[model samples]
Target chain A: MTERPDQSPLTSPRSERVRKAAALTGRSARRKQGRFRVEGPQAVRSLLTHRADLALEVFLTVRARADHPELASLAAEAGAPLREVDEQILRAMVRDSGDGGGDQGGADASPGAAVGGALVSPQGAIALATFSAEDPAAALGAVRALPADGPVTVVVLHEVRDPGNVGTMIRTADAAGADLVLLTRTSADPYSPKAVRASVGSLFHLPVLTGAEIDALLPALAAADVTAAATSGYADSDLFDTALPARLAWILGNEAHGLDEATLAAAPLTVRIPLAGHAESLNVHTAATVCLFETLRRRRLEA
Target chain B: MTERPDQSPLTSPRSERVRKAAALTGRSARRKQGRFRVEGPQAVRSLLTHRADLALEVFLTVRARADHPELASLAAEAGAPLREVDEQILRAMVRDSGDGGGDQGGADASPGAAVGGALVSPQGAIALATFSAEDPAAALGAVRALPADGPVTVVVLHEVRDPGNVGTMIRTADAAGADLVLLTRTSADPYSPKAVRASVGSLFHLPVLTGAEIDALLPALAAADVTAAATSGYADSDLFDTALPARLAWILGNEAHGLDEATLAAAPLTVRIPLAGHAESLNVHTAATVCLFETLRRRRLEA
Candidate 1:
């Protein structure tokens, strides 16, 4: 096992630029720089493997190096520059690089104490990599681009703001072999740390298209002969009873508010997860998993 | 709508004693007082409906009163004394109520801001009520008490400490119409605010038996002729292919570690949720939901 050396001199202009670019916290800044920070060993490893075509910059804390020796080798395999810092500094870096907020300084000052009990340490390691920005038009084209041999399944999330739920849905959609995961305007950024963490690196593998105009997407879905299946708490049609189409776009909405009237109008079919218990509804993520897996099961049965 | 008058004046020596008893914030204290704080409107409503027989006292902030006018009527219908305090004081009360730490003076200092976002504000209201104390003996009896007609499903959570997940499981178990929800010694308190909130009041509807000695409960489970179905991420048997018994105890483990070897050994059946995607594992809550609902579907089909 090649041990990661601490403090590689931060010399190259590109390396400096990538590091500075990774530090950009604002969503707009990240988009402008064409770079984003991926954290945790599993996520970083996944990004390195599946997204090897993209330019990657890796950073590891001393603790992370001790815990994951293979990470250094993996970075080398990808021909990426690697650097190590103290756990405190790494934590400060994560805090600085976090979504802009009032608690940035306080979080950095406190360091690992905040997330001390969790498995992935706040101060562990992170990777700065260029994510191929999938153009919405291109992503839509890619949906159209799928082979005509089977039905295509696209996931459309409307105002589902919780990143964890969104991320889990995308991961579940991928697991179920869905074609695309689309996010509406009000949805949390698919790349947000929480969403990425929940997705368990599936984000890198899946085609995630965001900021989609629902009006345009709906018509395109229709033109592609894809039916929109809207999930609702009050829908009369039971989810298990619905005749699932091969090419379907499953539409899920906010936890508090179901699909808006316009979205519902666009959806040709609506289904409900039958609830017998006292709970009014399932957690959005859990519901999504249930629906996606059901679709997967149906497809398998057909095959 | 009948307005409940300021209740500080109605405080009796008995009320003070009950308040002091609940102030301890321990299992013993909750058991001794036969009362525990149910934070937030949803929990309060749940308790009000299902556990109304144990109604004792209700407290609320003026703001809480405004937000939930039905609370006043519910309290009145239950014949529980209702009290109102400054919003700041209510916020402090709830904040202090948890873990029994925090300055009460600070609670009353910023009344409106204090209660604004918290699950429960001190000014919002506290209720003194009775809960049926868990008697492992009684739970065992209930296991024995299952009717001979239909299959009985019991949910056993082993060391699953996330309060929210535990709560959600309890709710899901109830939703699936499971017979009981059991917790190992290490699992979260089913009555904790977060768990209660996540359950959305299913906690009261479900028969929750916690803090069991696994050594004692294992044999009882065996005696009930309930097949133990342990969930694993990498078990040999696919969950969809498994023959789910009519009488089954589904064992779920902690978020990080799945079922322990001993627990797995105790299980006659082990099932895995197939992950076709790259993600390492499903969220514990999502996994539990999938398993529980699968069992429900299987049982229904068999019926």
Candidate 2:
């Protein structure tokens, strides 16, 4: 596993590549470089397992290398350049200074960035990978591939800015057998480290088409006869009684501002998950989960 | 709302109240003081609404007080002192450094703490309140109070240590119409600021009994005719096919170790949530949400 000729420990915390890697925290940098990072062992390993071709490189600490021999070999097979760095550099690569205010609040969400008011500490390895620079048309093609008689589900995020929420929704979509996830241009970046980790690697498992507007995607949905439904608290349509078509998309909004009128107007049906609890609503991912799993349950019974 | 005599901008971040509020980030301090903090406007509002008598004081920024006049009024009506603090003090009361490592990982997840690797910046007000120190026997008493054929559900968290997960589980249980939530002795403190915030005010709505053991609760569960079902990935019983009774309890394990063998064996049945995704298992809260909602779905279908 330690067969690499450049086996010397990378001690400099300010290496150019490491700095570039750290820059992936910003949306502009990730967009400019077409790359995002995967932090921690589980996420990095998943990248190798599912999307090895896109994995550009792997960085590990000495202790991590010793602890995870198989990960090293797996990265080797993926042809990702594996380098060992000082643990301090690895932490620096992902750490964010906690004192944040104003515009900077939403920029990074990289691994170990303060999220949901908890420090998600760094684990083992880290990986840098190239992400699709533009929306993947192939994601729509996958949606079209759904059988006429078979049940198909798609989860849509409309201005849902929390990266963790975005990731968890994707993971939930995968578990519920959704064909893909759609994130509007204003939603959290799906490739951000926090979002990727929150998805628990489901970002790689499922087709995630980001930076697309509902208006632009409407034509593709029309062609495929996919029914787009927006989830709204104000909607009169209850989830339990709503008619879910064979090919359907469930769209949720931001933690605060919810779905914009344009997005809600685009969908013929606006449905609400009937939450009996006193809390105003379910967490975005939980609401998506309820919708996704309900679709699955109904499909199973119908089948 | 401006009726409090001590209304002043708390500038010194090291003041006694600010220090005490900061100490709430630790479980020991919360336990010893019999006080826990609620951060963000949603959580603080809910505390005022549901547990107003328990609320001892509220600290808010000038802007927060101006924006949430109703909350200030509620606090005033509850006889809870309202104090204005500089935004910095408010931030300090809940902000986590986001640089964390080792065993201290789960200790502090207060509002604006680094969570899932990103600092979730705080939204608004903070509240300090005393929680019932002892496990509420009335929670179990409520389960016993259920009508002979009425649906009664209890959510059991077995050593789930993440404050976020603990809070999310409580919220899920409430949303799924569970009678109450029980935390095993080893579980995270339900009253921690992070857990309370994650609950999004559902914490105030539900009865959460902490410092409990499954062994002692099993007998009561049995006597109440509540079926104890542990969620296990290896369990042969599929969640869909499992026998969910009118009265039941769903137990979920820790994020890392999962359920200990002793706890698993004590449960009359073990059921697994079916996952079609490539991911190995569901997140603790997502798993709990799935189980709780599925039970709700089935009961509704039967009715």
Candidate 3:
């Protein structure tokens, strides 16, 4: 974990390498480079811990390096190059990632700066990693092949537009022991900096397959013998009362217009999380957390 | 609901009133003016529906006015002024609010702006309203006075620094039929633009008391006969197995650091939301949703 004795720290924010790293913040740039940027100590730690193989490089401020001594060894063990930079360079790279530096009201324009409100709180560590591009069909098939003795749970995001919601749901899905997370074609790119930051490295913990179609996915679930259920505010089926199958796919929809009529109708069952207060609906991510936790709770009870 | 044909629409974005409205985005300006700005159709709709008396003025673009005709009548009925403006003017006001304009990748710098990356998706409608500055003690007393036969639920945010999380928890608490939502002194301002927007009008739907001290709050809950439960990942008590009381408060801590030792020690109960997957901990807001909903579910089950 010790710093290399021979090399000087990367100092220039405008260096070609720095600019290239900053470019990964964009979707097309990430697509072309075949990698995404992950920021903050927690996320970087998760990267080094779970998906070290995908880590291309790791960058840290002197302060961050001191704060997290083990990250260096983790990076070294993964064969990912570890570079130490000044705080300015780290901030420059994070700022350029387009993760919401603009909204820190003038007063918070400094220390209180919560980039993107709260989702992107950069804590002086960043990494670039390649997320494997998995074919949705093959991904579903792989999960289906898991031993039949254990339950197979999947969460399908259908055209969800918000990256934070998408990422938060991914984290929740991961926490709930879901086997895989699949996003439809129109959903937010899980590789987006906001989504990755929000995921807090869970993006590395599970297989996240994007660019899927519900049309193909529903049939795939059927073939895999996984029951599919859509979440809707208007649905009559209550989540608590419904007995879920051993292999289940929980389908969540867009933030604004929920699941389209066809998608909702296509699902074998529709369930609503009962709202006891005045809120018209739960945030998509919050609802997903409840649903995932409920599934876990039920499964544990049954066991 | 008809727009006054006699009066011309407010057209200048640089006008004093527009600038003053923009200033409310700052904490000091909001405190000084005794008002906070609420943006978008959903929040504005909630303001008009629930706290109409607190609304001073409503601003809408031509399209917004046309899209929501009921707002005009609602504002008029409340004796609040409604002013029409152009989309440029509305955008200018929103942009100046300092809600995450900088992080939108250059391409999304326009339509895809996602000001503050989804937390602040400013639509054309905006409202200036007064949130009653209730003393934390008085607010707790009021909730404690609610019918004794019915369960009283309260959510306490202890030094939670994220505005979006603060707002989202408030919304979830409201949705879970919580009697009150309280925040400690170091917590994010619930009136912050990002928080208000993330709350999606639930701030108007419920009473949100800020600047509370956990020291006083814990004792207050004890006096009020409401059980206080601090959420901790390390706690031995599983949230699912614990039987809650008729009146309860779910205490949540900061995002990076969980509850402090003093606060944790003072709470009557410490409960952990079981994580079935690899996520180290739930986002503070996500955890609150699980806690609040679980409470609601159990109460309903008992009924």
Candidate 4:
């Protein structure tokens, strides 16, 4: 295990690095700087476990580092510089990282609401990480380059604005062994703190392309011999009855509105997860998970 | 078709019914008053469609009723008195309902964040409904009375504290066609505005018993001949390989610590949803959905 270097606590709430990290909550800032912040212990741990080299800076409160040795150890192993900060600074960082949660500078940052302003920071670790701008064209090229011997699944989310749902979809896509998670321009930013928290650390597991134009991406995937299937409640084919191809992409739409006409028109087919009972519709996350796992189940059955 | 009567908007945020509706957010109030609120248009519609007789009061904002003539129509169909209130009253009702997303009372209550506080209410319709205290003994008795010829699945939530997760479970239970959704005393209040919003409309679709003592509930379920299976990541039997009973109760544990030793030990068998990916575990809601759908898949295969 690599030893963490000693560092003085950075007491300033307006430090440059902290500001930069906080800026990551906004998609514009992330795209502009090619950097994003992963908050809380789970997401930071995921960064260390899956893609540690991308981690540039790790910040923890003195108490957090003392209580969560794994945070310091992982940061050390990832070779990222770790700094102990006053808890107020961390809250400022979380507050600056907007996710609808207002900032409370008061000392009563209850232990229950731990991690400064960590959107969901029960574990109290946050990281500043770098990223290569995800090129939809490049992602399309990679998906097309697969060896073609087994099932290849990709998930496309169009106009899905909920960060938590987007994050959960990424995690489900990862668990279902997806090749990529593509988002249309209208979708929520995959790197948003609320989404990163909801993804349970699966954000770093695979390629997640944000801001792809649906019309262009669908055609590109189709050209690459991937069949596009949109999950819909009113679709003609039941998911179980649909003949999912070896190379496929599952397209999901906005939480409130299903896929728009243009996006729906782009899909080759639509598969509806059968609901025996009455729920006018499934949550976007639930529908995505069921669709992904259903494919997984089918592949296993065929095997 | 019953016509909605013309009435003045209930403008005062401090009105008696508004405060009572707000009080329904607290468990003590719900238990003492024998009533609870179901917010948003979808839940209100479901209440009218399924158990209209239990509806005590229907409250809607002037704009909500004007825009959604269906809200008034449904309440009238349910034979419940519909009162048009000021939007401020609705906001106050939503603000008083706590899920820790502090009240930002400005009027951007987009239809998507359904219950003004649900963070996902897309509609502004809210209703007050009556519920009988769920007797675990009677609920178990009812499950035992079901005809044994078809699959009857029940969901048992043990100490799952998050109201959102609890509500999602109820909705999934409805979609999965589960006969019952029972919660241990340690679980979050199922009727809390947050949970009710998450359940979508399923809170009214089926029986959701709160304050169930798992140690007693499981044996009683066992005695009723409904096999009790606890969901665990470490269980010996893979869910796919396990023998599911015709009448089954799926027990899920707390979001963080998981099932207590006593609950796990009492379960006739523990079945784990197999995860082939690197994510440490599924979200409690996700796990519950997967298990129920897997059961659905298995039954479909057998049929």
**What are the Cα lDDT values of the candidates?**
0.67, 0.75, 0.76, 0.72
- Where does candidate 2 stray beyond 4 Å? A1-13, A60-73, A84-124, A136-149, B1-14, B59-69, B81-124, B134-149
Cα deviation in Å at residue B110, candidate 3? Answer: 12
Give the range of the ten consecutive residues with the poorest summed lDDT in model 4 chain B. B102-111
Model 3 / residue B185 / CA error / Å: 2.3
Tell me, by DockQ, which candidate is best: 3
Candidate 3 versus truth, CA RMSD in Å, comes to: 5.1
User: Candidate 3: lDDT of A188?
Assistant: 80
Q: Over the stretch A1-303, how does candidate 1's per-residue lDDT look in tens digits?
A: 122323555444245443453354345555666666677788888777777555367778777888988888888888878887555555554544444422111221122212111324533677776654535576567557666667677888888865656777887877767777888777766765546666777887767788776777787788888888887777888877788998888888875576788898779988888776677677666677778877876777787
The alpha-carbon deviation from the true structure for residue B230 of candidate 4, after best TM-score superposition, in angstroms, is 2.2
Query: How would you order the candidates by lDDT, starting with the best?
Result: 3, 2, 4, 1
Better of 1 and 2 by TM-score: 2
Give one digit per residue, the lDDT tens place, for model 4 in A1-303: 122333655667787756665655566667676777787777888998899988877888778888778988888899998877777778667655334322111111222221111224434577877776656666566666765666778898888876667888888888777878888766777776666766888888887777677767887888778888887777889887778887889999887688888777778988878886787778877888788888777777777
**DockQ for each of the predicted structures, in order?**
0.30, 0.36, 0.40, 0.35
- Between candidates 1 and 3, the DockQ winner: 3
Task: List the candidate numbers ranked by DockQ, top first.
Answer: 3, 2, 4, 1
Alpha carbon lDDT at B167, candidate 1:
75
The interface RMSD value for candidate 3 stands at: 6.0
Model 2 Cα lDDT, one tens digit per residue, B1-303: 111234555788777657666777776677777787888788888889988877888888889989888988999888998888788888787754332211133435344664433465556688888887646365466556655567888898888877777888788788888877888777877887667767888888867777666777787788888888888889998887776888888888887778889989999978988887777777777788888888887777777
lDDT of 3 by residue, A1-303 (tens): 112222455779877567666765666667667777888898999999998888888898878999999999999999888988877777666545444333221211232134435434467798888875536666566646655665788999987887767888899998888988988878887887767867877888887888777888888788878889888889898988888888888999887678899999999988988988788988788888888888888888887
